[model samples]
Target: MKKTKILFYDMKDYDIEFFTKYGKNYNFEMKFLKVKLSEETAYLSRGFDVVSAFTNDDINKNTIDILAKNNIKLLAMRCAGFNNVSLKDIKNRFQVVRVPAYSPYSIAEYTVAMILAVNRKVHKAYIRTREGNFSINGLMGFDLYNKTVGIIGAGKIAQILIKILKGFGTNIIAYDPYPNYEIAKELGFEFVDLDTIYEKSDIISLNCPLTKDTKYMINRTSINKMKDGVILVNTGRGMLIDSVDLVEGLKDKKIGAAALDVYEEEEEYFFEDKSSQVIQDDILGRLLSFHNVLITSHQAFFTKEAVEAITVTTLENIKDFIENKPLKNIVPQDNN
Candidate 1:
């Protein structure tokens, strides 16, 4: 009756605190590492039974091969996204499971917060009032009522967001590869195409997963199709919108404002504090220079409830693997 050993990569303060508290309930020995799971760090899993990764960890083919060589049996992603992993490479090497729906409400609520904060210029207003300069100059904001909101990807999070927006009296249009007309009817929204989403939506939110076809989906061509002064919000994967193209859109006033929770190249900077170091990413630097842009570290799904659920579900996934139970959260290959 030996306890299973789990090696967690990219460990944060909250992760350590919560996982340790939860680990007590299960007969599991856990080791937390600050370094991300990459090809270079995969060897560290040689003596461990399982490897746990976060959203930003590099789980490419090389890393997968190393993990396989190290005798790691399971690769558990603590987050919902598997875009960082090389799924095809992991097919025969080891099994992979993820917390697919830890807390859809967490992300959906955060998305609304971003939309409201940017549209109302609350960030600017806070700074201005703090300086004792509350003249209300250039602090105008429009009402969310009667606005046309187009949502990309009609997943659970997107559906929740649509329900929240419906309360605001805004018209909602959605675009999804697998459109559910029943859900659309139930939610009081219409499923439209990407072109219609671009042309009709006064505000657009990206809630889709990253895929081969979706990489840099919001490029110059897509931006050109969007309505002028459209408010863009991305709580989904960062690579969904090209930062370079977004900067250009902001410059040309094609995009009125943008709120981003993720970045394409965020592994080196997102979770860690770089306040003392200068930003080396030119696009990120340029993006920060804009007054209308709102950028946050990837924390949309970092709620107390969400983290707790993630911890419980992840442990259950491991427990199932050890007991030879069918994994409910197993990631399928080539959904890209």
Candidate 2:
């Protein structure tokens, strides 16, 4: 039997190794492409059975159309989020699959790490110690115990975070349109309204997916409702919070601190080394200048378990598509 021809695009060295090892077990002829999947790069997958993509790749309508034209049937995404892909355009043209729940624990743990680092000012302390300044002034941090924490989304990642925060004895209040009452009851979390969460929570964490309804969900209006000196953490989508509003809030001292693993306009420069070069994005540059803010290079999902799970699940999706079997993680056009 002929081995299945697979073109994996925008994959790193480790990712390529993982796929190469796993694909050999299933007799898949895997071709790794360093270039991203776009209209211009779609021709690279000609005569291939499937095209694998990563989060940063451009899987827009034109790209999907090109892939369909080139006889690429399967679009396999190694990441959970599919907001970058055009669902409407690829509905009938090609089948889509994604690794939806790779490792919620990785993201949850990273979120907590950000929260702790910001509150304790660990980043600043490290810098100060390196500079031979032993002064501990203005490094006061409150205990997590008995503090009110507001979680915007109550999905798998949020649930894991809630369990961890509960270990710290923090008061949990969550705002989700479809609340998980069972989990709330088991974990002693309160399902409150969005405004109540804004007014009451000492720390606010965003763990929701980005959609048309959730775009700029945390804007100037919502920022005004937040408690003064609130700590904000976002390990979710970057567009969930408005950059302009967040800068204004930081300027006005409305937000005491922020720990962001994602940014609204991070696509242009994230996951690459631009440190030696001049910073171009004004909002991002200003965000970096603030002493109270902590930013990471979208590495919340970078973990051994997460990476293995993503690789295994991605390959399994391709195998299922080729065998005409049921796809567990098939991404439909309307998952509303």
Candidate 3:
């Protein structure tokens, strides 16, 4: 039997290396494409049995139509997020599978890092110390012990993070529509309502998926309900927090400090080197002007373990599709 041929869009160097290595053991041939997948670029996958896409790729109805027209049978999402894909369009036309769980510790640890970095002014201190300004004059950090941390999602990553935070003796209050009571009991955290999460937490971390209810969920109204000088960190999807409202929140000191690994409207800017060019996005530009904010190029999921798991899980998804096996990572049309 011939091996299945897969066309991989948005191929990073690491992706090519990992996929090529792992795919060899699985009897699959992967053709790497660096271009972002779009309706026009769907032609590139012609004759291929499967198309593997990334988080940032455009996988709308038009792109799905073109992909179907070009004889693509399956879409293997190499990342956990499938928000970009038009699941309705691909419902019966083609199968869709994704890497639902990579190394949760990668993001869980990164979320903790962001919290510590922003709270202790580590980023600023690194810059100042590098310039021989060792003065700790403006560098002030608070204690984590006995502090209240409200997590919006109580999923795998959130569970891991709560365990880590518990080591610091901080109170963990969570809000999830579908609460895993067993995990809450096992992890020793409270499952509170959204309003209680907003008013009570000293530090608010977003670890939820981007859904209709969560889109721009952290807007002006929500921020207003938060404690004065509350710290905020987002390692989740960008649109979870409205950038415009976030800027306003930062301006008014409603949010004492903010650290973001993802941003709204980040598709055009993130994952690219635009060091020489002016930041044309006004909201992003305003965000950069804030002294209390730290932004990272969405790298929370870039750990070695995460990458390995992502590659293996994605290849497994592809294998299951080709072999007509039950897919473990088949994402539902809507996460409603």
Predicted structure with the largest TM-score when compared to the true one: 1
Candidate 2 per-residue C-alpha lDDT over 1-336 given as tens digits, one digit per residue, 9 for 90 to 100: 888899999878889878777777796888898888888899888899899998888888789888998898889998988999988887677889999998999999999999999999999999999999999998888999999999999999999999999999999999998998998999889999999999999999999999888899999999999999999999999999999999999999999999999998987778777979988999999999999999999999999898889999998898898899999999988532
List per-prediction Cα lDDT, in the order shown: 0.94, 0.92, 0.92
- What's the TM for model 3? 0.96
The residue-by-residue lDDT of candidate 3 on 217-247, one tens digit each, is 9999999999999999999999999999999
Model 3: colliding residue pairs: none
State each candidate's clash count.
Answer: 0, 0, 0
Q: Report the error of model 2 at residue 74, Å.
A: 0.5
Which model, 1 or 3, shows the larger TM-score? 1
Off by over 4 Å in 1: 334-336
Give the Cα error of residue 87 in candidate 1, in Å: 2.1
User: Against the hidden true structure, what lDDT does model 2 obtain?
Assistant: 0.92
